[model samples]
Each structure stands twice: as structure tokens, then as C-alpha cells.
Target: MSKTEVNIIDPSILEDLCNNVTDGKPVNFELPNHGILHIDKLLPFICVYRYSELDFYFARVIKTQASYIIVDDNTDISHLLEGIRLIMSAKFETFLVLECWPISSEDYTTFEIFCPAGKAPSTVKALEKGFKSLNETYPNIAVEVNDTHARYPDQLEPLLNVEESKKTGTLVIGLGIPTLYKNSKTNELYALFFREFYSVFSETIKRAIHEFIRVQTTDDFENYLMFGKTNIDEITLTSDAELAEISEGMSFLLRTTPVNSNEEWTNFKKNEFKKTPEFKYRLISLDSEIEKRKLYNIPIDKVDDPTIAFILRGKRLEIEKQLTMLEERGTKNFRFVGESLYGVIKKNVLEEAKHILAVYPKREERKSKERFNCHEFAAHAQKELDYYNTKFPNLDLTLEIRNDVAGIMVSKSKLLINNEINLDANRCDALIQHEVGTHILTYCNGKRQPLQQMYEGFEGYDQLQEGLAVIAEYLVGGLTVNRLRLLAGRVIAVESMVNGATFIRTFNLLRKEYGFSDRISYYISMRVYRGGGLTKDAVYLAGLIDLMAYLKAGGNLENLYTGKFNITHIELIEELLYRKVLKQPELPRFLERESVKERFKKLRNGIDITELVN
Candidate 1:
């Protein structure tokens, strides 16, 4: 057939060939007139083949459907077909079949190629002849071909094996070309040709076809011949430049495959998280811990984030369980002992011992006060404490105005305050009711419990204590903007320290930028940066913020006093109380006041007490 009469099918047509062939069978054949083709039905049915340069150039069919394709020819046909035939043929298939085949020396000598199928000698010879022909025909086209296997010793084995074909080749050659074919029927013949030629002129045809595809540009071929799809636009086909551009575009597209967008990627990650079983348990554990703590009067630590609260709940559960057990067992023991005959006798004796112990009032253990500049205020605070203590004898209370910090707690001995702070008439009265009335009351009440730990503290006790203290101050109208600012400053300083900024840097920033006084700035910075990065300052602001949120959410003030950091624990406690699973602990000595108005007045107008007391 004339060269013009010879039709080269589009590369895509190979897929059709692969699907049609191996209608389910392993076929092996050789076309001495063509080359070799082999088909094996492995999962996708792999095929291997090689074709002589003459067979490849003159033969009519080139498409197949087998899973892989291996072209073997020694004429640079890659440029002629724009390399589309090789890539497109391999795109759909799992592999590409290759072998080295050659054209007659007398015909041409300008295609240089390499053989990866262990036929380097034959491949080199064919390439030398082909390059000479190509130099003669297209001298302006710069072509340089090297036998890389021989040049790079490390690459030799990898290039020859079909498995390493993808990584080793200058152009990764796939195996079993027919498997990549668009048409299965075409693959049967193609596979036969591949097996037959390799089994026959194995090394020669393998090298020859390799060289042919190497030099051929798909741009020169008709669109229908290269891709099996016809272009209706004759205008697009009219120019060599247009065809070249189209070929280049297609090649670029094949090389760079598009990836999924970010949103899709995020969705994939989220879905993966959902599939994890731990996610469910985390939620349940957090909820359960919160509920249990609320029942036991233990409080959650003041944490801003709900996630952090969840984490702390886990950490505190053990301590809370111990406290609960102590309460349950101790209460039962007290009740049992009281009911026994010997218990009643011993109780009376114990009471006599307590009365003897209480005969002389216990002296305050905190620093003793002297006649200072603010003697009037100190004396007033002392008198108020004595009166409150008398009114509520159950409370263990003492008032001492010294160089102690602001804010009060029923420490083991004293209601302390910094004498340095101006404790005017109004301030002294406020401190008496807020501190002596509320804090002392709570301490005494908690101490009355069979378990001493109730008077002590639990894991999340800080949040409850701080929240209630602030609420007490608010109810008493003593909470000030200055106090709020101090809290905010603490949070800011703590965050800065955590971020690795120095104490000097924080102090300077707050003093100059925030316009805080040197005293305030130094105190705030020191609070956070003290003793190798104390993170305590963060608690004040974090606590106040949480307290506000809880109160705004309509949380009950009395319930806040009940304690427990776990939200679920609080919920459970509330439920239990509703069903009487637990009773509210009585207001401690510090909380009790004859009148709400009087208590409110004291907390509101309470002393300019240094924040340290709380």
C-alpha cells in the first residue's frame, strides 16, 4: 500500500481495542511480517508487544485495548505523533508494552533510540542508522539520543524491567500496550503481534519501534489518526502551528493532573474525624464528669474554653470521687455512732472535751495588729467580726487588719486585709459583712461537715470560689471598674508571658501603651511572669468572664455556691436536688448575714481590699 493509503488510527482507539480483545483469553502470537504480541488475562489482562520499524511504519493497525503497551521501533516517531500516541495509549491502560524493532538501513538513518527490554546492542545499532537518516532529512531539528542504560550503570536494571519502566526511562515506558488500548479487538491482534515479534526477532524489533516513536511528533499526524477523534474544524487542521499548539496543550494537560480543591480536602479531613470512635467518648466523659462534681460540692477550675473545661474535668475526677466517698462514708459513720449506746456516751464525753478546749478562746494565728495610723478602721472591723461571730457562734471567725492582701477567705485563723489600703468608715463596714459574713460563714459551714475535705478544696474549687466571691462582691455592689480592669490586665499579662515576651516587655507595654500606672503595670507583669512563669494571673480574668457568662445565662446564685466545675455535673446535681438525690449544703459562716441588704451593703462598699486576699 502507498504511504498515503496507510491509515494510522488515533491513540484513543487503543482503549477500544483493549476492551474488545481478550474477550477473556490468554493469546500469544507473532507476526514475522509485523512483530510480536502477547496477551495474558491477569485482572485487567496485561499485554506485551514489539514491532519492527518497517511493520510499525507500514502496518495499518496500531491501537489496542490490553492493559499495557510496549512499543519497540528504531525510528523517532514520537515527535511525528507529538508523543500523544504513547501517552494517550498508556493513560487508560495499566501498562505499556515495548520492544526494540528497526527499519532497513538502506531506507533511512536518522532516529536514535534506546532499548529498555534488554536489547541494547540492537537498539544502539538501529538508533545510529536512524539518527543519520534524520540528520539528512531534518538537519535543522536538533536531536541527541544517548543510551542511558550504558551511560548510567545504576539505571541499567531498572530500565530493562517493566516494573521499573515508569521511574527509569527518560520517558517512562509502560508495559502491555494493548491493555491501554481503547479497542479490545485491536488489542488481540496487537497482543499477538507483540508476543510473536518478541518471541521471534525479540531484540531487533524491540529496538526499532522504540526509535521510531522517539522521533515522530504527533503534531504532524492527522487528529483522527493520532487520537481516534476527528476535528470538525478544518481551520484548526489547516496550519502546522495550530496542530503543534494543540499537541503541546494535550501533552501539558496529561502531565499535570488537577487536584481536589481546599474545601473538598477539608471535608475529607472532617469526615475522617467523624469516623473516629474516640470522638463520641470524649463528649460523654466530659458531660459525666461535670455532673458528678456538681453533686459533691467540688468546683471546676475557672477555664475560658469549654474544651479546656472538658480536659480539666478528666484530670479532677479522681480527687472528686475520693471526696464524694469520704462524704458518704463519714456521714454514715457519724449517724451510726450517734445512734449507738456507747456512741451517745462517748459523744457526751467528747462534747465535754470540746467545751474545755473552747473555754479560753483560741488566739488568732495570723499576724497581730498594733496601733497603726488607721486604728479607728481596724477597731471597727474587729468589733463587727466579734458581733457576727457571736450572732453565728458555729462560725470560727477572727478579724485582723494588717499588711495582709485584699479579698478575704476563712483561712484557718483570720479575716485579713492590708492595713496600707485606706480602710475608711464605709470600707471597713463593707469588709465586715462581705468577708466576715460570707466567707467565714461558708468556711464554718463546710467545717461542720463530717469530711474535713469539704472545708478544704477540690480540683475545680477555684472556679466556684472565685465565681461566688465575685458574685458576692457584685451583690454587695463592691465590684468596681478598677477591679474589672485589674482582672483584664491579668489576662493580658498572662497571655503575653505565655507567648514568650519578657516581664520588662509586658510591663513597658502595659505602662506606656495601655497607660497603666507603674505600680499597676509592675504588679500585673509580676503576677504572670513571677517564679518561672506563673500562669495564675490568667485565672482571674478567665474566672470573671466565665462567671459573667454563667450568670447572664440565668444560672442561680445559690446553685453557684453549691459548687462543681462540670456543667453536666451541675445539671445532674440540680436534677438530683429536684428529686432530692442530694441536699444543699448550708450557707457557711462567711455567707450568712442577718439581712440580704446588710450583706449586700458590706460587699458593695467593702474595703479597697487588695485583690490578693481572694
Candidate 2:
């Protein structure tokens, strides 16, 4: 129903209630939220004190209380919902927007009108409150009823006449339920709800959002979700089994023990070999993996879908590159920098490193007793795992001490810790947030996806993965000046290796010029020269710079959190979702955390980490 359908029996009542809103004094309406919504000098301005309750958006609600519409100073709706994190049921796109007038509760009386269309349990309670106000003040409710619900009673009531019973003659049409539109402030809920609908939602929500869109807003939120669907049961042109096999196959082939035995490397360092250290690495089943990939034989030309072809071919390329990296792992002039092009530190990265180096030359240390042992880190990892598993009860997590990685996320369900090193308690939380919070979280979310490559990672994924890991550090407040300097040092190390600088040269640069401790310099140099000029470490700082720019531009981190997505892959991920090729990422806890929203806001407004240290 449009405004023309509304018949306000007592126009003076609504006007009188609205008029009660005073400039000198404002009326407060409590939300089912964490804070109060203050309506003062009603119509143009409303303040949501503790507005963080709804999400991250900090705003003054806009004009036209009758419509509950909010707009920026320029009336642009874009900024209103930008970066808003709405927490809602994943079932539907339809939700209610609360609007409280200055009218006293004493003047309100409640009664129900049968509104079958608006009868969803999620919305009816709020409807009841608004109805009570309307019934007490006005003789007839001013509601915009959709054509379907209006016709529903017409069809049912007449059919009842066919029964010719006493009950059939007694009929009361339930209409006049007011239609509510989410103004700019509340409008973000629709965008967020739609994202949930697909990432995703249940049937009731779809219907509710569709009905709500038709009855309330002038926009087409429902049709937009439908997105040219010919029918409801749409399926994509891809095979889950095929993708899963390829993912499993590559992971199987990628296995290997550490390149140089830890003992031999310890001796090499102890010998003070004033040259590049040499070691050996071998792929366990190189031939078998090659045979399997050949059998998968990606037929790009035969593939009807470009996305399927691209993903398959990309996986094949990565497989071949990974094989080469493994085969060439420890030799003189050996460059096993897997996907090194994506890891290049650019001019901006160099500039940022210079800034970081200038700011954090002095190393910070925690007291020895404050250092947490391996068991303590395990406790922390377990707690972080518990936090994750609590959020998603189905995730079966396994914790194990492994020598292969310092702290590696093996898969959606497995975590590998070095077990040899004690951790600083101060750094443990950030590590958990980095390893478990980001890697494990994204892995689990990817597992929930229909596409297996989500967890496995696609081409160009390394940059964003490490970038997000570093950003997760910043968001969780674990990124200290020393940590920032460490990342900067990695960029410097990788740069030195890229330019064929010797390990000794890189070590000395970090130790003397950068003022890094010999231990720290040795560690950074070893990582960069691990495979004789591995440029992969460059991604940590370079990716941080790129991801920072992305965040500053209001890119939703939740999308990246959905899977092991590269920044470049965001569009592809969206397209895959649009074509039903991939499922929406399941757990985007990073975006959902209230603790990080303010940080994101600060980042969006622009921040400089190097400035903090000095």
C-alpha cells in the first residue's frame, strides 16, 4: 500500500504526538539494543547514544521521522550504511525498524489487527508496540499493505462463503498493519541481511525481505538478491568432487621435511660460514602427483565456464610451481620463491620500511619470567581454539606440536606448533589472533564454502593471507613497534635477496644500520635466504601496505575473512557467489568483533604506525 491508501482517522492525534517533541528537551526511547535512542527536536535529528550497539557506524539519524529516513548532510545514502556491521538472524532479509514518538506511554493502548503477511514472529512484537500507539491515538491505522496480502483475505474470505456455516459468515479482515522503511541509518541492515541470505540465510528471511521490500522501501532489495534468476533452484556449472580432489592431491604432493636438518643448520650457523648456506629438499611423491594432475588434465577449451577453467588451470600452475619449488629447494643460486612476483616489495613498501626503521630502532624486551613456555602457548592456542569452536561447535580442532612450522595452520581442523620455543606472554595473544584468529578462522569459513579451493587458497592468495595475518595483529592490538619493525625488516631482507645481496650483507645491514640485535638479524636473514633468494617474506610488509589502503577505502574485511581470498580475487569471489559457484564465507568473526570496529574506523580515517613509536 502507498501513502494514498492510508486513512488517518484522527490526523490531529499524530500531529499532536509529533508536536510534543521539544527543542529544549528530547524524549528517549529504549531499544532492545544495548543503548538508548534519543529523539530530540524530532523529525531531523536523533542520536543513538552508545550507537555502537547496532554495529560500527557512528552517525546522527537523519530527517523525516514519519518515514524514519536518515541521510548525510548532503542527503547521500551511501555513507549511512558504509562499514556498518549488523548482527541479525541468518534466516531472512526482512527485519523491523523501531520508531518511537514523543507521545507518553499512558496515552497508548494496544490491540492486534490480523496481518497475515506481517505475521512473522521476528517482526510482530515491534508491530504490536507501534499498533498500540496507533490504536490509542487514531481511529484507523495508516498502513501500506502489499497487493498480495490485500488479495489474500479477498480469496480466503470468499472461499469461506462456500462453506455456508455460521463461522464462515463471521469474518474479520486483518489489514492496516503499518509499513516501515529502514531509513539510511537502518537501511544497512538490508545490505547486511542480503549478504547473510547468501553467505547466507533461511527461507523465512528471504520471504520477509522480499515482502518488506515490496511493502516498505521504494528500492528493490529483493529483486537485487534474485539477480536475474530464472527460477529458485539455480545450480552452478562446477563439480565439488573434482575441486576437492585437486585440492587434496596438491596438498599431498606438497609435503616435505625441513630442507636442512635443524642440527646441520645449527652447525652451519655455528661455523660462521661467511657464505650462503646450502641444504637439500625433496618432494615425496613428485611423479605420482604429476601423474594425477595429468589425469585431471585441465581442458580449458572444453570448459563451458570460465571460472571453473580459470580455477582449475590456476591450481595446475600452482601445482607445477610448487613442485619446482620443492625440487629446487636448497641449491646455490636456487630460486624457489613460489609466486615471487606477488611478493615484490614496491616503492611505497620501501618508503614505509624506511619510516618504520627510523621509528623503531631500539628493541623492546619483556621480563624473563613474563615469557610463556610452550605449555603456556598451547594453553593460549587452546583457549583461542575454544573461542572459535564455541562460535562454531562443529569445527573439530586438533592441536599438535610439530617441528615443521613455528606456528602453522595445517588445515581447517589442524594446527602445528614448533613446541621448541617459549613465547612472550605479551606476544601470545596476537599470535593466536594471527594464526588461529585469522588463518584458522578463514580456513573453517572456507571449509563451510562449497568450493574446496577456498581453504586451499587460489593463485595470488599468499599476499592477502599474510597481509590479513599482519592486519589481524594490528586489529587485536598485538602489533607492537618491534613487530612492525620486524615486518619492515622482512621486507628489507627480501629486497636484499632480490638484488642478490649476500646473507652476511643483509644480516649486517639489519644489525648495524637498522640497529637490530644479532639474533634478530640472523633470523630475518635466514628466512629471506632460506631457499637461496626466497622473496616471499617481502609480502608481510608489502601486503600490509596494500591491505591498509584497501581498508582505508572502506573495503569490507568481512569479505576477505570469508575465505582464503586475495584482494584481486574479491571480484572473482563475488562472481562465483553470484553464479552460485562458491558459498558465502561462514565465519567473519573479525568483522563481527566490537573490539575491532573502532580500529577499522580509525584505519579508515588514516593511521600511521611509525608515528606511534617515536
Candidate 3:
């Protein structure tokens, strides 16, 4: 490890390190808890010196996560080691500190409280108040709360791990929380409140002793939410053009390992679901697909990039799952797909939709009707395709009408419109933008990159793809109230299926309670129940939620427009662009149109779905 990794600063080596090293470079240190800290620069924050032998560096936290932190410092060696102790003493095992800062003499003491941004203000006040009240009672042990600084540490995993450890009954220091632990050993919910102080004097000890005697209950544990930050596993990054090759070779497995897309499955399930059903069906055996999948097994163990390896592994697993389901339809199909897509709806997401459905009233149909037959609709859709041609002269897009597809973008170059379904005139504009502007545009943009996965997309790409498509409807002033309700109803119906509700039950729930038309309800319910419980329909609303949050969080829509991507890849995609590993999007000039720009602003500014239609 480099010198910057440790938080310890010895005045003896301070000048030596400063003179030997240039500013704005990374320094590393080995932490006792098996962690590494990479200080980007010793950013001249603050310094404390005592006795010719002792010194300190204070680092301002810039970006904090669970297990690592990137700190900026002008210079320090030992101060980083000290910071490591500070982090671990808060009950984290290992962490990385990237950058540096710190302080004075005259017997000054520092008490730092690390908490989430939302809780920082309150935590500071509460800690100060608790100390002040203690000081008022015992004047001899009184100390002023002098300085407070908010920091962003890159490593948050260890701190979060500390919370999990508390499930057993461990007392953590530096973290200001009165934990009410459920004592598993005693088979009871027991709360143990501990106030720990690692101060220089005995005053902190007296306070800790007093608080230690306080037997906290499970009720008090809920109030401690203010003391910690929410943490997620860190996203590992790599710049391996090799991933493009590996992904390309593996892509063939997906085509052969397709899920049930036959209209018969939908019709039969909808028809049979009129009764309590244990419906079964025969599928062409997946013997060939399974053998091919095995032959093209992902070399996950050998992939150098952990992130890429993980993603490839998931893709391979999904392919295998889909292949297995083809051989075993019904509950087996439902089980495999649900497990593959992680289709199990969480309680919170389910409740959120229920709330929307309560107030999301349906709308009268737009003046435009599905009056055009198949050939006429194909001719009409061609007009929209012509409009796109003028904008993307080199896009090489093809449009064809088919019985199987309902306006699906195929092979990133072809748009297939279902010839059997009537075309809704009002929705043609929305479908044009959804299919041509959003889907085809992303496919074209992704084609500019070396990675075909960008164009073809990775697993779980449907959520982002469909979300952007649906949002396009809203952007173009065609997101009818009925359409938005349909999206919401899908979520409700999906939740019902996951909860073991049958097709007919979900259909009635939508038609009777939500007032959807019989045909609309039947189709929506069919979507959820098809192929032994496909949860893909739920992605419409879930993807919308994710996209909305991304926009609100200052995410650039251009990143998403660049390819078939997941919200989780935003950072990596941007990083790739920054490193020239990925190319910037080549969007059509129509995006710059004033009307589209206005729509972009509306999307960027934010939207409330329930009120959006009105």
C-alpha cells in the first residue's frame, strides 16, 4: 500500500512526503482491518502537531460508500492510518480512504459522527444535546462541541456490515446509536443501548457508564435510523474490449433459448383460466438449445473483470433457465422464469401501485380509433417510417407488418407491426416515437460502439427499453390516461399472479375494480399469466419508476439513449465514454427540434404519473 492509504501523520515524515511526492497523485496505505485507502491528494485541508514526534492530517470526506473512500489530500502518511482506526472503531471491518484533511493543540478533542446526509443535522444536534445535558449535570466533565464537518467516504460496506453484525449483539463505538438488539439467545426482542466514547479524558467514560445502564427496548431501535448511511455493494469497473467479443459469441444462445412467444399460449391460458386452473402445455423440447448453451458456456471463472464476469454469468443463467422452462411448462415454467427475472414483487412496490390505482381514473378514448385494417395500418405506419428516414438518412431501418409482433423493433434494424391488431390512430404518433425514435435510435447509437451488447442489450434490458419507449409517449403528448392506467394495472396484475392469484381473478380485479374494458383486462391479465407466469409486464411501470428517478437524479437521458442498458450501468457507461471505451450517442437531428426539446424539459423537470394525463 502507498503512504496515503493510512490516516496517521507523523510530523517527522510530513515534510519528507511533501517534498518527495507531487500533489494530486494517489497514495496508498494498508489498514489493520485488511482494507486499503487511496488518497488522491493530500489536499492541504488541515494539520495538527504535538511534540516533535506526533502529528495529524484531517481529510474531508468527498465520496463515501460502505467499504471504500476516495479522499483528496495535499499530503499525509500516518494520518490515513489513524483514519482507518477511526473508521473500523465505528465497527467496520475494512475500508479504503481515498483523500485527506485536520487540527490543533491546547488539549482539544475531536468527536466525529458519521451518518447519512439526511440524518447528519439531527444526529449532530442530538449528540451535542446529549453531551450538553451531561455537561450541565457534571461540570467537571464538560467539553464544548467545537467543530463538525460533513464528509463523503467511498467505503460504506463495512459500516453497513456493522448494522448486520448488530443482529447478534455487538457494541459498536464512535457510531452514536442506542441499539435495541433483539436477543436471539434468549428468544426475545431485547434492546441493548450502549453509548461508547473513546475520548482522551475520563468524562466520556462517565457518560458511557451512565448510558450503559439504560436498558433500551425494541421501540428505541427505530429511532436510531439517523445514525448511519444506507450502503450498497460497490460497482466494480473495467475497460476490457475483450468483453465485446465474449458477449458477442454468447449472444447466439439467447436466440435459440427463446421464451414462449406463441399466441396460442396466451389464448389457451386466457380461455382455461376461466376456472381454477392447473394448466399444462407441450413445447418443442429445448434439447438443442440446452446442448448449445452448455457448449457456449460463459468462462466466468476466467473473466478478469469481476463486473463483466458477473453480468455474463447472469445472462448465461437466464438463458439456461429459459431453455429449461421450455422442456417443463406450467408451474415449472413459471418457477424458472420468475426465478430468472426476479419477478417476485416486493411489498413496497406492490403497495405503491395499489395507491396509484386508487386515484388513477380511466379516460374516454381519444377521437382517433383503430379504423385502419392490416394493409392500411401498414401503409400508415410506413408514413411514420418515412418521417424517420428524413431525420436518420443512414439509419437503414425497415418496417414490415406481421401477425406475430405488435410494433416490435427486431434485430435493431427492423420494426414489425402486428397485422392482426387494428391500429389506434391517436397512438400511431406515440408508437412511432416509441418504436422509431427511442428504440431504433438507441439501437443505431449502440451500433457505433465496439460492444454489440449495447445494441442487442443485456439481460433485463426490456425494463429500460420499454420505459424509455413509454416515456416517449408522454413526451409527444400522446400518453393517454387509459394508457397510463394500463401500465399501472399491469403492476397490480403482476403482483396478484406472484401472490398465487389466477388469471381470471386478476382479470376481474382489473375489470371490476379498476374499470378496465373486458378485452383490455383480459389481455393485461393474459400478459401476466402467460408462459407459466411471466413477470415481464411489471417492467413497464417499474421501468418508468426507475427512469423517472434517474432523470430526477441528474442522469443524462443521452446515456440511456445510447443502447440497450440497465439503470445500474449508468456510471460504468459514462466511465466507458470518459475512457473512450464507448462512443457518444449519434442521435438524429430531430431530437433538437423545439417541440422535442420542450418535451425533454418536461421529462427532466419531473412528472407525477397520476396527474400527468390530466
lDDT of each: 0.38, 0.52, 0.51
Residue 76, candidate 2: alpha-carbon lDDT: 21
- Where is model 3 poorest over a 10-residue stretch in terms of lDDT? 192-201
**Candidate 2: minimum summed lDDT over ten consecutive residues — where?**
80-89
Q: Give the per-residue lDDT digits (tens) of candidate 1, residues 385-496.
A: 6765664576656756554342333453366654555432333444555555455554554454322333443334444555455556555445544444555566566556
Ten-residue region with minimum lDDT total, candidate 1: 276-285
How many angstroms is residue 323 displaced in model 1 relative to the true structure, after the best TM-score fit? 18
Candidate 3 residue lDDT tens string, 525-577: 75677556777778777888888878867788877887887777776566456
Please provide, for model 2 over 165-253, each residue's C-alpha lDDT reduced to its tens digit, 9 standing for 90 to 100: 12211111232211121234333333332222122112222233344445533444433223212111112224434544655665532
User: Total clashes, candidate 1?
Assistant: 151
lDDT over C-alpha atoms for residue 534 of model 3: 72
Better of 1 and 2 by lDDT: 2
Q: Which numbered prediction scores highest in lDDT against the true structure?
A: 2
What's the CA error at residue 346 for candidate 1, in Å? 54
TM-scores, each model vs. reference: 0.34, 0.58, 0.55
